[model samples]
Structure formats: C-alpha cells, structure tokens
Target: MQVRFWGTRGSLPVAPKAGTIADKVADALVAANGRSFADKAAALAFVEDDLDFATGRSYGGATSCVEVDMGEGPFIVCDLGSGVRELGLDTLRRCAQEGRPKEWHIFLSHLHWDHIMGFPFFVPAFMDGAKIIIHAGHPDAEQALRRQQEEISFPVPFDWLKADIEFRTLETGREYEIGEVTVSVILQHHSHDSYGYRFRDRDGKVAIYSTDSEHKIDQMHDENDFAQFFGHADLVVCDTMYSLADSVSMKEDWGHSSNIVAVDLCHEAKARRLALFHHEPTYSDADIQRMHEETIRYEELTRDTDALEVLCAYDGLCVEL
Candidate 1:
C-alpha cells in the first residue's frame, strides 16, 4: 500500500504573498553571490543543493486530504479538503483513460469546514457513473455535508449531484474490511469528537491516520491503550499543528497537537515511522522545515532503546509501505 498527501495544511488553505516570493528570490540571489552559472542545469543544481527548501520549494496550501492506494481498485482517501479538488480531477482523468468506474471511499476526521469544503468541488461527485462512499464516526456527517451544499451556502444543491453518494457512520473500536484493508476507528479529543483511524493490510502493514486530535500531556492515561492501538504500525500520520508552548498555553483546547507530543506518542506507541501532519497554515515553509529539524533533535534527546524514523509531511508527498 502507498500513502499520498494531497494537502498538509491545517485550519485553512493559504497562499504565499508576493512579498514572500520576493524574499525567496532575494535570498536565492544572495546565496548565488557572484557565481556564474554556465547553463540552466548549473543554476538548477545550485537551487537544489545550496538553497534551502523555503527558497526553492513550498509545502503548498491545500488543506488535509490524503490518498491511500492499495494496488489497483477503488480509491481510499482521508478528508475532502481543498486539495481533494485536484485529486478528483486526477482520478477522473485516470478513470477516463483506463475505462474504469469512478469509486471513492472518503474518511472524515470530523465535520470541520476545512475538511469537508472540497466535497462541493469534487468533480467526480457531479458525474453520473461515479460512486462515493463517505465514512465518518459522527452520525450527522451526511447532514453536515448536505447543509454546506444548500441553496444559500453553495450554488449547487446536494440533491442535484448526479453521482451515487452514500454516507456510512463508523462504529468506533470495531474493525471493518473495506476491500483488502482492515479499518478501525477510535475517538479522538476534538470539539464535536473526531476519529483517528488505523489501517492494516492483509500483509500486516499498518498505517494510522490521526488528525485534528489533541493529546493531554499532564494527564496520565493507560499507555497500553495507545501502545496497542499503534503497536508496530509502519507509519503514523499525526497532527503537529502547533508548538509545544502554544499547545499548552494560549491554544490549550485548540484540538491540535504539537510535534513534541507527536514524537512522544509515537515513541511510546512503538510506531516505526512518524509523519508530522496537519501543518499550521500560518507557518511558512521555512518555519515547518525548522520545526522538523527541531523535532528530530528532540527525538534524539529523548530516545529510548529503539530509533523512530520521523518526517514532516508536505503536499504531494508519497510513502510506500
């Protein structure tokens, strides 16, 4: 199985301002510093090797959608944020070229607008032969989505969509087999209650998708529960939307975790790889890169017997399991 992040931003989508781009350009030029590039390849190499990620690349602006592909079949995704529009277009193109039916299985963390707003723009949902199955732990998931598409909110009504869309309410703690993947959910700490999902394939490869969930640092809970839940998982996608200081202070009840908390949880859970997700929208690419570096340093400082691989997720990142 493979995991792809279509969007990684939290809260909402954001774009770099013109001033931000100008700064990157100025920084790059300063880094070049009187060097003469013989050709485009030389300049490209300089950009790739010498310049920092903030100057050369961006983490992107799309909010919270991910794709989990299990070989060839229907598609499984998490969230339907602004990024899903691009995913929808890509899926539609692929289906058209391969002569395959459009089928999508989407899991929602919660009914948050940033997470569900892309559904209205999902191209496949407007197609006649497409089939969309929306899964959520909340019983009001369907109604919440429908309300967004009502006359006053959106130009098109939910009932007017031509696709066959169904909503399924998930039962927490119970595993359900969806195609070749075994999926189970757990209630997470969030307003209106969100869900964290664990997916285990037939080969026993595991991936946990946990977003919009906050972890309590001061409170003591049975470590065994989380350890068993994340037990030997190959990858854990976690919310690291704030700094530890912010998470504990001003944003105490913001329903988002910090990289410090994420590292600690994945370490205790014995998860192999941790992907920092649900990036704070206000953070620039450089800020996130610095945070990633700091998280790695923190992990080293707190390492126990085992080593955990850590990475900061970005839009368009692909991981094979």
Candidate 2:
C-alpha cells in the first residue's frame, strides 16, 4: 500500500508570510555562495541537492487529510482537512482520464472543525455520480458535516450538493472489509474522542493511521494494548504536535502527543517506521526540521536491538508499505 499525506498540520491551517518566503530565498542564495550555474537545470539541481528541506521547500498549511492507495480502484481517504480540496481536484483529473466511477471511502478520525472543514470545498462532493461513503466512529459525523454547510456558515447548503453521500457509523474494535483492505478502529484519547485505524492487506502488510491522539503519563504504564494494536505495522502515522515539555506542562489534555512519546510507542510496538505527523501550526519550517532532527537523535539514543525508522511527515510525502 502507498500512503500519501495531503495535509499534516494540526489545530489550524497556516501558510508562511512574504517575509518567511524571502528569508528562505535569501538563505538559499547565501548558501550558493556566488556560484555560477550554466543553466537553470544546474541551479535547480544545486538547490535540490545542497539546500535542506526547510530552506528549499515548505511543510504546507493543510490539516490532516491522507490518501491510502492499494493499487486498486476504490478511492480511500483519511480525514477531510483542507488538503482534501487538492486531492479532490486530482481525483477529478484521474476520473476524467480513466472514466472511473466516482466512489470514495473516507475514514474520519474525529469531527474537529480543522479536520472536517475541507468537505464543503471538496470538488468530488459537488459532482454528480459521486458516491461518497464516510465511515466514522462518530454517529454525529453527518450532523457535523451538514451543520458546516448550513446557510449561516457556507453559501451552499448540504442538500444542494449533487453527489450522493452516505455516513456509516462504524463500531470500533470490529474488523470490517473496506474494499481492498481490512480495517479496524481503536478509540483514542481526544476531545469528543478520536479513532485510530489499522489497515491490513491480504499479504499481511499493515499501515496504521493514528493522529490527533494524546498519550497520558499514567496511561503510558498501561500501553500494552496500544502496543498490540500497533504491533508489526509497516508504517504508523502518529500525532507529534508538541514537545515533551509542552505536551506535559502547558499543553496537557490538549489532545496531542510528542515525538518522544511517538518513538517510545513505536519502539514498544516493534513497528518498522513511524511518521511524525500533526505538526503545530505556529512552528516554522525550520522549527519542524529541528524537531525532526531532535526526534531522530532521541530515537538513536534510546535505540533497542533493532532500529525503528523515523520521519517527519510533510504535505506531498508518499510512503510505500
């Protein structure tokens, strides 16, 4: 399975200002150190190879939508954050070329505004013949979606949509076949409660999407159940929205976790790779890159017999499991 991150921010969507963009350009130029390029290709190559990610590219501003592809037909999406709009546009292009039926299976984590805000702008949801099945653990998923599209909020009403949309309230802990993958949910710690999904294919490959979740210090002692849930997964996309100091002190009960906790959890689960996700909106690209470097160092310092790969998830990132 291939997992693509459309959005990875938490709480809110934010973009860099003009000053930030200028700073990146200035830094890159300084690093070039007056070197001359024969062509734009050579300069582009230098930027790609020499410049670090934070200086060369952005982490993006969208919040929490992901795509899970099993190399099959059905469209499987996770969350409906602002990133979904881009995915929706891309889906339209694919549908236009392939003439495939517009069927989407969306797995929601929770109905936070940031997580559900993209539904109104999702192009496919506005198209005829588009069948959208929103599978969520929350019974009020449809209610929340409809409420967002109310005239007071959005110009377009939910009833005005051209597509056929269905909401399926899923029972957590029960295994269900959703197209090419078998999925199961585990209740997570969050406001109004969030759900973590485990997707496993016929070949036994597993990819777990566990975001907007907080791990308590008291609960960490009893994390064997979570360990079992994450056991042997190829990739575990987790919430790492704060530093250990902040998550424990100032941001306690804020429903977010730290990269330190993420590494510890994945290590205990024996998961192969952990993608740190749900970045804090206030953090600059450099801040996130520093956090990623720090997390890698922490993982190395706390390594067991086998090493677990750690990566910071950014928009447009693709991971194969």
Q: How accurate locally, in lDDT, is each candidate?
A: 0.90, 0.92
- Per-residue CA lDDT of model 2 for 1-321, tens digit only, reads 999999999989999999999999999999999999999999889988999999999899999999988766778899999999999998778777877568889999999999999999999888888999999999999999999999899999999999999999999769989778999999998999999999998889999999988997656977777888999999999999999999999999999999999998999999999999999999999999999999999999999878999988999999998
TM-score of every candidate relative to the true structure: 0.95, 0.98
Best by TM-score: 2
Which pairs, if any, clash in model 1? Answer: none
List ranges where model 2 is wrong by over 4 Å.
none
Give one digit per residue, the lDDT tens place, for model 1 in 47-156: 99999887888889999999888866788999999999999998888787876458999999999999999999999999998999999999999999999999899999
Cα-based lDDT at residue 306, candidate 2? 82
What C-alpha RMSD separates each model from the true structure?
1.5, 1.1
Global CA lDDT computed for model 1: 0.90
lDDT of 1 at 191: 96
Best by lDDT: 2
Backbone clash total, candidate 2: 0
